[model samples]
Target: MTNDAVLHTEGLTRRFGGLVANNNIAIQIHRGQLHAVLGPNGAGKSTMINLLSGDLRPSTGHIFFDGQDISGFSADRRSRMGIGRSYQKTNIFPTFTVFENCRLAAQSREPHPARIFSNALSYRTVCEAAERAIELAGLAHRAQRHANTLSHGEQRQLEVAMVLATSPNVLLLDEPLAGMGAEESARMVELLQRITPDHGILLVEHDMDAVFAVAKVVTVMVNGEVLESGSPEQIRGSAQVQVAYLGAEDEHHG
Candidate 1:
């Protein structure tokens, strides 16, 4: 593993009965870089993130985070170790106000996340962290509104903010721009670019345009295997990539 790598996977594999969801995959994410995983549906992108986040144990192989072996850690444990994730689907408390949601997530980063009735409002540090998250996610104006009331894009942003509240050094973003208008997607790209200087982001997205625009390094996966990893320019020009993944439509758009 490279000293600069914050996350590393070695021969990672996951199997469900007869189905091999992930097959001997190896990945490395350098600290403070935006690494993108691109593939078609059912190419095991989500499965890969799940393994990295400790949501699922690998059938074989190991995972390391910040130079620590974390293959056996639980999801919660991984979160405490600076691994945070934003789901492809919006995962936020629907009834909770935006501020309340952020506060709750921020509180989870604390040693105690289940301290009910402890008056999180009185915890200046938690409150301040929540406020910063809200501002970063561009939800400060809607901080008082319920999470479900926000538009699809705003909800996605809130989910990201909620994850950020955990103060993670490495963030796993599963399709951060999944459901959004073009304008919303543009705004999300801008937001992601702004946050890159502060954290390492591993992104799983289908939007080739967005992937090409934001990612300094792109990993192309096909049929549960990584076909190539390179800079956007190299990927765009590679004959193997064009034959294996980037079809004619992708070239036309480019």
Candidate 2:
């Protein structure tokens, strides 16, 4: 693993009974870069994400965060250590305003034990973090809107903002563009581009066009193993990658 990598895996593997979900996978996520994982269904993309996020312990191998071994850490522990994750499904408070939703996410980091009954607005640090996250996610204009009232794309943006509110340096995003129209996808693409300068992002996405557009590095997995790992151009040019995955996408688009 590179010494400078914010997050890197060393021979990461996960097994369930006789089935191996992920196998001897080693990947790196560097600061200020977008590393995307691509593959067909059941290729272990989600399993890898879960393992990195600490939702599932690796059956073998190690996960390093900022050069420290974090293979034994729990999901919440990892989050507090500057690793934030966004799920495929929208996880937000529909009844809360965008700011309120973000604020709640921020509050998770510093739940004032001394002021358990205090008004949430009284927490300056939490509020500021929430505001910063909303801005970073490009949802400042919608800060006052109710979450349920936002469009599908905006909801996705809100989910990202919620993760940002935790003030993480590394982000694990799972299928962030799963449901969206062309315009909404474009907006999300722009948002991702804007944020890539600061955080190390590990994205699991099926939208090949969007993945190729923003990712600085791409890792293709097949049958729970890495088929290729390289730049977008290299991935596009790889006959192995085309045969395993991109060929099917090309056929669908062609």
Q: What are the TM-scores, per candidate, against the unseen true structure?
A: 0.93, 0.92
Best by TM-score: 1
lDDT string, candidate 2, 1-254, tens digits: 35789999999999989899999999999999999999999999989999999999999999999999999999999999999999888889999999999999999899876876788798899999999989877789999999999998888888888998998899999998887768767877897888899999999999988999999999999999999999999999999999999998889889
| lDDT for each residue of candidate 1 in 34-129, tens digit (9 for 90 to 100) | 999988788899999999998899999899887788999999999988889999989899999999999999988664547776876888888899
- lDDT values for all models: 0.88, 0.92
Q: How close is each model in CA RMSD to the real structure?
A: 2.0, 1.8
Best by lDDT: 2
Q: What is the lDDT of residue 246 in candidate 2?
A: 91
Give me the runs in candidate 2 sitting further than 4 Å from their true place: none
